[model samples]
Target: MNVLSHADSALSLLPPVVAILLAIFTRRVLLSLGVGILLGALLLTQFSLGDTSLFLVDTVKGLVWDDGALNSWNLQILGFLVMLGMITALITVSGASRAFAEWAKNRIRNKRDAKLMTVFLGCVVFIDDYFNSLVVGSISKPITDRYYISRAKLAYLLDSTAAPICVISPVSSWGAYIIALIGGILTAHGFTESGHLSVFVQMIPMNFYAIFAMLLLLCVAIWGLDVGPMRQHELKAQKGELFDESKGLPPGANADLPEADTGKIIGLFLPILALIAATLYFMISSGADVLAADGNAFSVLGAFENTEVSQSLFYGSIVGFIVTLGLAFAQKLSMELIIKGITAGARSMLPAIYILLFAWSIAGVIGQLETGKYMASLVTGAIPFALLPAVLFILAGITAFSTGTSWGTFGIMLPIAADMAMGSDSTMMLPMLSAVLAGAVFGDHCSPISDTTILSSTGASCHHIDHVITQLPYALIVALISIVGYVVLGYTASVMAGFMACCAVFAVSVVGLKYYAR
Candidate 1:
């Protein structure tokens, strides 16, 4: 807190680089994040141990307790994580997951069907990445496991689809946040020809990364296109080693959980359906209430823009938890067993919660160090007109990868992207903005510290490192294709041309991958 005058200098790059590299090589997420946090605090405090200590303490304290009050947003999200864990445990212990798997096995033929089902669910639950990541994994896992699909593959399916779908869908939390930002940028730059929502819709075809990533994931699921580390995981899974036991089980996975043979499929479907309904209701109601307070009409888009997503998820989880408990009582599970299951389930989430806490802490320190600002500053110069979109895509990817938050990257880079486009080529504004969106999602997909990535791993009950490593190759493939797409869009100034280029590249990549895989 004492300060570094050159906070936005190259020195700001140290923490994230060190953290990310250490996480990849050592596969120790907590230690890597802790080191990053410590380094950032020291740098921010100019290496004063006392100041660094205070900064570290205050950083974490601020997450849960800010300004002498509980921080509603962060606390609510944490509550949701815990409640989700408890519900998951109850479902497993009561054998609801097993029951559902048994019920589905008759209709679903093989791994391809299971994988496709996962993709379908991932697409359907596009409201929030956090929700999509966890719920889809839980629903798909039992089915996937039945077909000898690796948890890492299930995680890949979850991670690859969640952000891309949310980023593209207008009704999603990510879309709302982004549209609001685009609105501000448009207003500031005096672009009144089109509304923010319209611009966002137009940019959908231009979001090359999001569009292509989903396409590639579907191909992978249908064709069994396993590559790199993912192939190793899949092979091991086929040999009856679903995951390396030595690396430890993922969050919310307890091998000791009891499986009741009498568990009914209704027990599984009811609680999950209830959770989704409750979450949707709360989300709409919360957003509507905010709109009404501000004397605005009740519009779905307006409601989403004002909705408190964390609050809604937390409330929905509470309803889900109650439903789960009622189902357990109806199943006649013993009181002691139920209590034990709840404790175990909550305890399973402790690891994820701890990692998230540290991740958030380091993100705060990174912000104070102006890491994103430093990254953004490097692109503030004369750039080639035809390369601006592709360049912004790369820059945004790097910034989001380093900062571990796509939203943060959007806040820091979107305005810069807008100004650059306006000054250089006003016609390229939409494509440029779309590149930033694509790049942010690309970076978020690769970052080990990203919350969506972590939740994806937790949801699939796979080792966090396995999820990161397995998905990295797939992410890189789509990102490269997206870069090509952006470059084409920049040169041709046609969204269709860019999308076609992406499709051609993707088709070739898939064919090449299939041959290589064989």
Candidate 2:
């Protein structure tokens, strides 16, 4: 296989653009993504049929097996997804989901509290967005289901909170990755007076989209400020239509299964707790091992930077699955039923796995085309200093949206943002970097191909397209506010001012919408 690099041309935009537009209009995500992958391979192989076919085969094959070895990261993620599905299925079969829902029914008296519970859980699980996205959904879905909250809305809460919280938390995978990247960028540009950690801490307030999006989600949940497609979903939910089964359920949902009256809530709590504990333990231990190998002291933050997130999640899920099986057997579930549950669970995850596989394929194709690089190149020279942050925000958003990866957007745009700040106004560096983070998240929330977006929907048991459509209007609102905030910060070079401006605008918007609903 040849090492494919970026094409460095406008043609790089064609695949993702066509794929995104097709997904939006046709609502056939797999087909749309497949078309995009095909188009990219054609372009990459210069339309040679044999070469393009080989490239496509190699791309898919590399997902699990590459260079005579297992691709542990990708394989582990798939393993975790299946393990989570199995856990959820066993819980359902044991009637633990119903027991938990009944337990919550007594204390959670209203939809508002139910929605807030989801938000709270989302906030508490901040280690990794992949973990946060799925675990929180599985835990909260039953409570929200009892309250008639739409899966679409549940997914919104999950999606909005997952990345936003991860991006800001210093102990998280997102934080560690960003901190390390910022360290290199700082060194490259001769900004040595401040360390990357301090700079990252300072930029927290400057992350307008992430902060504002959290606030907006809270407002939406508390005030019933549903808008656009979400409003329709909510209305239907109130009428006992929580999910549109016509769109098909994401893998791992056993909502329609019968509940055993003898089951206990502990069945639900114990497995999930075990999963969380095991995951955190692996993350720390693995990271510590790396630090030891490099002769560095083991610190929590250092561990996070070196942690294998997918591998940790995979191992954690296996622990959780074992716990779940123990609980099921203790409940006196027959071997036949246990076997059925396991098979059903694995089968349920197949859809999510397929979508993830194709999504990864297209993302790889996008990388070969240098779509992000081409997009980043558009913002290179001669921008007004006052608009630099704003421009970076929009550019990062577009890149992430088109490429279907926020982290990739950060890799492509952050250094350029650093370079631009260095050349123009070095004092605006943190603000500019913050803007890139904000925009990448903004774009990620809106992109149909984004893995977190897919995971959110799967976790919530909502249709993928439904989650994408319902979340878009809300994401756009935050993006617009963030852009204005960045423009203000760029001109004034004041993180405080920009943050305040974003808060004020968001408050007014939420209040106005509440008033309008009345």
Candidate 3:
């Protein structure tokens, strides 16, 4: 492969920096991403207008079609996404989601119960962050609303669980992507003994941001500890003012189809169960050949290690879509209604799909420019290895924050982080990797331009900026704790001890913030 390269210079930072600034100022993610892509294309073409235009055309075309940059992997992901959209839409159109909501409403008598249910639902939909954000937000919003929970707080619950859960879950899209990145880096460097899945599992304990975020969410929900702007929002919501008049609301998704007369909760539960079962089955079956090649019959972890995650997800989602359609038909839905639901679901995913395409393209441009190398070069050996995890955490956090995409950050940073950890004491490698993953998630949680964040706000029917402002404090607190945890882990190199110490620190910090910081 003949890779394009550019000289390391200040110009290398233009695309991401421009994107970040535009996104923050305009609060228009799609525009920001498009500008970034255009800038990158210009730079890659050496400022030739003709070449940049042609590159843009080719890139846009390639994003959807198979012949260009949208290879098999990209297509598989797209398939999974579309299928998931169809499933979600079908469930909604079938009135299954409404039934589930009504059932929960009867059971959930108070705010605490409502919040707990929201968190629980968010955790349950761990297949993908996008799915988690949309489904949890849509299903839990009405229940939370009846209890006077602010849309901002609901958005927080949705956003907090999305990436944080996905990053740690062994079978999620995020996990699969991380595994692939790790596996590629390992193979590129000729290190074969350390399997990506094994390292990913090991790093789970060290992913302090994700762990702390979930814990903090539960604590906040259980105790009703609202601080910063969130406190104001919650108080106002309690006074029958769910939204601030000053802050304009973002448009929410409307399922215009009429609810079925005989809506049953089973309609929702069965499809979700089917999705989970299908995913596991496909994951295991797809890896069967690889496991046999290694003279192994089956082990749960081993099957996951050998699985073609994208392919498996694609197959699983297809099965899920089929099951959802079957259930809709069983409910005697008209053909027009079913088709409308499928199209509506896929339509809702279009914005996210556009963002992913642009994010990926800009990331490709960054690779060609060796942006990772340039960034890595700034970190010198004079910084003690003991502090490397902390340093890398900050760096990765900034990178992901600016890009508003954790997957892009992982693609750019994991390889460099892996190379940096090579030939060092093995204890340090997992921590460094964990730091990268944690930082990326932290950044994604905070970035207003983040697709997950945007989806969360939409899901909760909150103003976008309100969601960002209210959630920033909580995310920052957790991020600070994660940085401290990484620093401790760096010196201790003991996951157990480090986790205990970090938990102690979190306890003190959150308690103080709860009672005093407000």
Using TM-score as the measure, which candidate wins?
Answer: 1
The list of candidate 1 runs beyond 4 A from truth reads 5-7
lDDT of each prediction vs. the true structure? Answer: 0.90, 0.90, 0.77
Give per-residue CA lDDT, model 1, range 14-43, as digits (tens): 999999999999999999999999998888
What TM-scores do the predictions have?
0.98, 0.98, 0.83
Clashing pairs in 3: none
lDDT rank, highest first? Answer: 1, 2, 3
lDDT of 2 by residue, 71-185 (tens): 9989999999999988988888888888999999899999999999999999999999989988998899889999999999999999999999999998999999999999999
lDDT of 2 at 140: 94
**Best of the two (1, 2) by TM-score:** 1
Candidate 3 structure quality by residue, lDDT tens digits, 1-518: 12245537657678878876786677676787788878878788888888778877766666566553457666786677677677777887788877877788778988999999999999988867766776577668667877899999999999999999999987776786788777787788776887778778878999999999999999889988788899999999999877775644343533355667666888877776776688778877777778998898776655665777668767877888888888888899989888888887787666556655666677666656665556656665688888888888888887676566788788877876777788566557778888999988888887755667776876676776678889988899898888888888888887776688779888997788778635
Native-referenced Cα lDDT, model 1 = 0.90
Query: How would you order the candidates by TM-score, starting with the best?
Result: 1, 2, 3
* Worst 10-residue lDDT window, candidate 2: 250-259
Pairs with steric clashes in candidate 2: none
**Candidate 2 accuracy as TM-score:** 0.98
